[model samples]
Target: MSVTDTEATGRAPGGGAGPEPAVLTRRLRLVLVLLLTTQFMLAVDFAILNVALPVIGRGLGFPLAHLQWIGTSFALCAAGFTLLFGRVADLFGRRRLFLGGLVVLGVSSLVGGLAQSPGMLIVARVCQGLATAAVTPAALSLMTTSFPEGPLRRKALGLNGALMSSGFTTGAVLGGVLTDLLSWRWAFFINVPVALAVLVIAPRVIEESRPEKRPELDVPGAVSVTLGLLAVVFGLTQAGEQGWSSPGALLSLVAGVVLLVVFYFVERKVAAPLVPLGVLGKRSVAWGNVAGLFAFATFTSLVFPLTLYLQDVLGFSALVAGLSLGFLGLGTVTGGVTASRVIGRFGTRTTLLLGGSLQAVFTAALVCLGADRSWMWLMLFAGFAGGIGNMLAIVGFMVTATSGLADHEQGLATGLATMTQQVGITLGTPVMSAAATTAMTGSGAVAVLGGLKGAIGVNAALVLLGVLSSALFLRDDRPAALRASRRSGHGRSARRKGGGRFRPVA
Candidate 1:
């Protein structure tokens, strides 16, 4: 059957109605491209400004204290509203939210590019971030639901995860190139065309989707979660840059913990929870997220040790050290491109185990590549292996986590998955730095390299915990919605077939 004909006949992709694998549709391919671009855009913007921060501050005369806002403004808002916007998409329509987010993003980019003042630029950045928060999971959920649960879906997701994973690394390089070649403003201005192009193509290719029953916003849960997450993220960033014991960081961390605890209880009682607490109990979702968190934490943290080793020990210039990260970027995209096939061969459990094991071994191997060895060869090898392992684990976890969720809940699923990841990367840098500091008890190159090796070793050991966790806990199941709506219990036949427990999905 022709793809358009199937759509006309009302066979939804990955819905209860299901998509047929054999049909290749032009519209579907375009939709996937548009959605993957959206993911890459969201990922890239995060780091695009890193290299341009000095210029931005000088251009707009931002005070030293306020300079960090260039990055934090967008990130904090994106992190805070991601889950809420995901729920918003489910309740309304994913396409509707996605398009609206595009408008916001494009507008914000334009404003940011033209900004005459720091406040204006910051405001634009926040808006851009909010738009990213709105679009990221909405687009992802749209893509996931539009593809069937076989090779096609895996391929699309693997690519999405790849672009998303490498977005930051790519941005770091692109930021330098653009800033040196053109101007820092190009970073913000560049997004405008991408958004415009996506806007032009999206409606023709993508379909709209929302829950059958409209859902009400859980205001309490939303407010608490946003504040709680923002605080936690801010604290982590502060700790990473400053110190764990910094008063501001400690206070924010404490406040975040309290708010999250309150949010947990608040969710249980809310008539319509932002995240159905039971969703956390889903073994696939829980363990997949846990695995992703650990994998990302280890992979990102390695950057610190590697960067330090390259510069301090090898006496490379800043540009050379930065260029060396190309290997990591190469591996990340390579892994993303290959993740699906690996998963296909090994299954989610086996793939995750392999990823964790590789990450551990690669991280530990860094310890032996001291001043005596060729830093270039060892670093490249570590980056290649780390990137492969991290991306492979990411693909497995993403597929597993979203498995069995009701069609509408896919946004929430993606949001949670993304949130866990942001938190891990946020916390990882500080933890790694602290570990390195503790390891260096003496003075000179011996002490510094010793600390570097010690930190890498410790990080490697920590990764093993995630491996063990996945081995013990990661498993798959048919979502409760496969048979019935656990919330309404309305379908008499579905209810009879599916009680509280989920059956296995083939």
Candidate 2:
């Protein structure tokens, strides 16, 4: 039998063992459940603390200037460490790193729950970010490896995307309820039990896979990229607070750009680069990542300003604000579930264009809201539309980005995509914040409303840019070899199923 035939038969070359029995299917389901649970927990942490921020600031006596750091700290650490951990996953086992990350996440949550000062909380949040850095890429790699590329993979990816989008919106609502009924501390504490459960179950349920050959960690490349991203994110954030022309902010921004340029060159020369240049060479992958980054950035900006607007301008309680954001989650779920169908009918290009255009329209509408506007339903609709856009754009982008990669490179591909998202959020948040603040120079509610409008307008424009990039740069053609390989693999499997006769099953 040919190599393809062996693979098709789902047996060893010597036919030593056949496929597992029905009991293994049950085990596979359990594995999927555990993985999804961990993913949900990670996603929730990304947004859960947003709803609790005001309360945390009030409780800890954090100044307005420093309040943003509560979120930034986590985001920055996660962004900084993602690439490094991706490399680590390539060296060590992804499962080992994933389980270890869960432990760190649980422990950090416990510490964060007990934090008495903003400093300690920031440290704990950073730790949680580090844990996430490890968990997310590994989880994605695991998913790709466990499920073969086809309808099964598409379904899994769609569900994963839904979990991710829903987690953010759900976090806001849950954070509010937890903060109001219990304490803001519970927001952090809640992760303890969830993380514990994931840690215990993941090892047994999730299959362990290692890189084909252990790859050397590109320490210098990692450091340079980390510093570059950190510098840029810090500068943007400072510009929001210290003025865009400030010497400190300008210098940081310039330095970040230079460092990133250097890092790019370094990747080209390194034997085992942090991110393979070949991956970026693929136009679909490159454009897809860029679209994902911009879309996510718009989202990052929307969350902070919207939360503030509800509380400060509309006088909504945290819980009410959180509940309002649930519309976004519902929309996200709707989009995620429906995207595969949309893609099947319309292809990725049209789906992205439509999603992006709708998102831009709704995001712009958010700017028109006011204290007297009793259009709560309008707010919900806008959020839902934006969620739909996000789901279509994100899932399409991811599918395109890693479309033709080898199984071993899956971790690296997932890492680069995730890193882009973090960078987008890091950059987008501060820029939008600054825009809003600048728009609200006066003290009245009208001034606040104006500033928020400006911010939302900026986000809308960014979404439009993402749409243009996707439409212009993303290619529609699948590599002919990849398509052939898939067809051959499927044919061989069918033949094997018929006991060496080319009889079709089902």
Candidate 3:
């Protein structure tokens, strides 16, 4: 068998002793559950704190202005350290790093739950962010490695995407309920048990993965990229609060851009760059990330305005508002499960276009929202539609990004895919909030409604741009030989199974 055949069949090159098919299948299922649960926990953390922010501020004596830092600190560290840790995981050991990350996340959540001062909570959040940076890529790499790129991989990724989306929405709901019933601290405490369970179970189920040839760390590349991302996330956070033209935002953004450029140059010169320039050359890696960025930016941003509309205009309590979004969460689940089949039938590109279009249309429907009670059902319908479309786009983008990469390179690909997603999530709300804030005409609820409509319109437009990028630039660029080998493997597998095969690219 050729190298391609070994990969396509998910078997040893020489038919050496391996686990029985039934045993292997069961193990894969266990691994998927473990990884997907972790993904959900991390995703929940992203939004859980947001709903509890005001309460936390009051409890910790945080000033109104500094409250955003509680969230920003996590985003900053998570985005900054993600790529470096991604490479570290690939070189060191994925399972080892994954376990370490879970420990960090648990400890941080404990500290956060027990925090007495604003500074302490903020510090804990930063640690949690760092933990997330470590866990996400490592977990993603594990999934890609455990499941060969075919129906199984697509199905795993689809569920991963669904849980990720739903988890964030679910976090909003849980945040409200936990805060109202127990305390805001429970929001932080909830993660501890989940992390502990995973830590105990993960080592037994997940085998470690590392590159066959370990290279020396690219210390310079790591420092530059990490700092550059930090600066960028800081600048974006500042832009959301202060105007983009403010001196601090301006300086941070410029410094970030320059540092990123420097990192690019460093990569070109280094023997073993943290992110190999060659990986970026793949069409899937480049364009797929672009699609992922927009998919997240629009979908995540839409939530902010919707939350505001519910609380400010519709006179809903935070808990009520969060509960109402149950429809949105359900839609994401539906879309995520449906995407794998869609990809198998129409391919990732078509899925991308279809998802983006539907997302835009649903988002645009929000423009009709009003202060009347009649608008509630429309809001739910639009949220459901938007959620479905958003998940489909995200899953398609991830599948596209990770496809056509070698097992060793899966870490880098997932890291890049995940980094873009974090950046998009970080970017979306601030930009949309800034736009809405600027469009606000007065201090009344009416003014807020107008601003929200404008933001939703901007959200629709951004998603449309994502669709255009997909239509114009995205294409399957896998090597012909690799593609041929995959087709042959699929043919044999399908024949043996009597007819179920998944083809995700044209």
Q: Pick the candidate with the highest lDDT.
A: 3
* Candidate 1: tens digits of C-alpha lDDT, residues 1-506: 22342462235443456545655466777778889988898888987897789888888899988898887778788877888888888888998999999999999999999999999999999999899889988998887778767677788889988888788678877888888889999999999999999999888767787877797899999999999999998988888767899999999999999999999999999989999989988888888899988887887778778778877878776557667877787887888899888877667787788878887888778888767546678888888888888788888888888877877788899888778767777777788898889898788777788889888988898789989999999863324453345457655554467884445569
lDDT of 2 by residue, 377-456 (tens): 67888999888888887777767666677666778878887787777767776788788877887887777878888888
In model 2, the runs with Cα more than 4 Å from the true position are 1-25, 57-67, 116-119, 367-371, 441-443, 477-506
TM-score of each: 0.89, 0.85, 0.91
Model 2, residue 114: C-alpha shift (Å): 2.5
Model 3 gets an lDDT of: 0.88
For residues 1-506, what per-residue lDDT tens digits would candidate 3 score against the true structure?
11222342365644332332323355577789999999999999999988888888888899998898988999999998998888888899888999999999999999999999988998899999999999999999988877776667788899999999999899999988898889999999999999999998888777777876798999999999999999999999899888888999989999999999999999999999999998998888899999999999989878899989999998998888888888889989999999988887677888898999999999999999998768999999989988899999999999999998887788888889889989999899988998798788988899999999989999999999999999999984444554676777865675567656545557
**Cα displacement (Å) at residue 357, model 1:** 1.0
Clashing pairs in 2: none
What candidate 1 gets wrong by more than 4 Å, as runs, is 1-15, 441-448, 476-506
- lDDT minimum window of 10 residues, candidate 3: 1-10
Q: Which ranking of candidates, highest lDDT first?
A: 3, 1, 2
Compared with the true structure, model 1 gives a TM-score of 0.89
- In terms of lDDT, the poorest run of 10 residues in model 2 is 1-10
CA lDDT, every model vs. true structure: 0.82, 0.78, 0.88
